[model samples]
Target: MADLFDNINDWLMQEALDENPLTSIVETFGRRLVEGGVPVARISIGRSILHPTIGLLDVQWEQDTGQVNTQAVPRQIVRNSLEIFDTPFGELSKGKTDRLFADLRDPDEVARFPMFEQLAARGMTYYAAFSRSFGRTHHLYERISNEFRGASLSFTTKRFSGFSQADLDGLERVLPAFCICLRMDIERFVAGEILETYLGKISGKQVLDGQVERGDGQEIDCAILYSDLRGSVTLSQTLDSTAYLDTVNAYFDCVATAIDEHGGEVLKFIGDGVLAIFPFDEANRPRANMCAAALSSAQEAFARAEHANRGRSGDGLPALHFGVGLHVGTVIYGNVGTARRLDFTATGPAVGLASRCEGMTRELDTPLVATGAFAEHCPRAGADLGQHRLRGFADPIALVSYPLT
Candidate 1:
């Protein structure tokens, strides 16, 4: 048993060095333990994560199927529920216990947790849970206790005799090494989630691929979509801070959802405005496809706003309104900013033109406006609004109102 544990530890170290994915690591670890005569029937690992939408990441492996399954618990549920504290893993995580061991066959022990009852029903005889701290504080887990900064791992066995002293000892000895590998993979996963949450997916990948230098960027032709909430300044002055923020978020949800659904990436939110792009790909997606996608996204945004307005009006709140500008041109996409604080975004004359077109929304009294460059690729009929002088450009640019009304 001691030799088996030593071999497992060595294998974990190599897996950590290779940066193996957490799912694959957990699956293999469960199999190895079973093969080493530990008789582990099920293994579960749960970690608190930093993310906009997800609060907990759980990975479970079953010996029967030799497969691993992962689940992302929503932040809202994690914040609001007390169920997490009711389990054995929760006790270990809160530092109330160093480890847990229970015989599912014992009615008294099975009564301790609802999970034990289910495990017994599934033919699991014994259960054990242990926690490994990541050696750092997590804001989300602070309320649960600052000590719960890492992962909770649990193992169950279906053996009639349950886990013997040797099995428990071997598992305990190898756990630390396995957890070290898990931490490495979890940190990598968190970094990706955070970067993708703040920056668009494309930009996040670029940064991960080592596009860190300040001037590292490339000019790419794409369709730019700019959308801004109307009367935001007046709304800010009239509404309370919380109400104003809620309104802004609602508007953003509408715009961002539409853009994402139409294969566009929202780059940033400038106050009450959104900047997004649909990059043209010669192989899979062409320029016309990108332009059409941008146009469809703009129309979808307006539809979503209208739907939201119905609920707002029913509640006696003012209806929401916003404008979108669509254009296609080349822009530099990459890292830009001060030496220490950098932003991954798109910038160039094309971006400026898109913003200017959005500004024309107010003048033209239209919800959606497109530059001639964008209109050319869109098959949908649009009402030509002839040449109009924009703020930045020296010459007047032609604009069109989409949907032909």
Candidate 2:
């Protein structure tokens, strides 16, 4: 039995080195425990994860078909779930007990936890659980770190012989190693998620791929998009701080969601405006695709603004208005800034042209405007607005305005 445990430890360390997902590690460890002369029919592992999208994760393994199932739960859902406060798993997590063991054959013991009753119905004869630490802390688990964050594991057996003391001891001795391996996987996942959430996908990938130098970047041709909320300064004065912020969020959400849905990455939110891009690869993609995507995104933003305006008007608030600008050209899409703080974004004439087009929206009374470079690729009808001098341009800029649909 000790030799079997030694092999399991070696295999677990290798899994950690390979950087396996936490769910995969938990599933494989449970399967090995059952095969290592332990009468285990079911196993469950739960831990608090530091993630941008989720608060808790639980993994369950079943011996019947040798399958594993994993679940990620939001913090609100976990707090509202009654099982978190009543089940033996809950008790163990709370430190009320370091371990829990119950004979499912006993009706009184089965009544102690709702989960025990279910296990008994599933033909489980014995159940045991233990709590271990992941050696880390998270904000979501701050108040409940003693009851969560570490780790909680449970095992059940349906066999008449049930789990022996040695079986329990073996699992307890190996719990620390298992926790360490799982933490390695989680740390990698968290870093990736945080980077992707804060930085645009392409930039995030480049950084992770070792493009970390201060000036690391490349020039690329792409369609640039700029959206700005009209009359934002006036709105800020008319509404309270909370209402003003909510109004700004509503406008930005419309533009950002549209950009993301159409394969554009929003590089940054410049106050009430958004800067986004759709890269064009002439070798594989047609120029028309980038222009069309930008137009489609503009249309979506208009639709969402209309929807949001109706809601605001119903609540006695002012209606929202915004403008969109699209232009196509090459730009340096890479990191640039101070030595201490760098920003990964695009900077070139195309970016400036998009912003200039957006500025013309209010003057020309058009919600959507595109420069000649962008308009040439868009097949839709547009009213040609004659060349007009814009800020920072040496020559007059030709543009077209799309009618609101």
Total backbone collisions for each predicted model: 0, 0
For candidate 2, give the lDDT of residue 170.
Answer: 79
- Candidate number of the best lDDT: 1
> Among these predicted structures, which one has the highest TM-score?
1
Taking the tens digit of each residue's C-alpha lDDT, what string does model 2 give over 1-405? Answer: 547777887788888888787767766777777767787899888777767557677888898888889888887766667767587766766656668899999999999989899999999999988887656444464336453567787889998877888887877777777877868866776777777777877778888888777889999888899999889999999899999999898888889998888878889899899999998877665678877887888899899889988888899987879898888889998889989999888998889989999999989988899998788876666789989898999999999988656
| TM-scores of all predicted structures | 0.94, 0.90
RMSD per prediction, one decimal? 2.1, 2.7
lDDT of 1 by residue, 180-206 (tens): 888898788888877888897888889
Minimal lDDT window, size 10, model 1: 138-147
lDDT of model 2 at position 156: 94
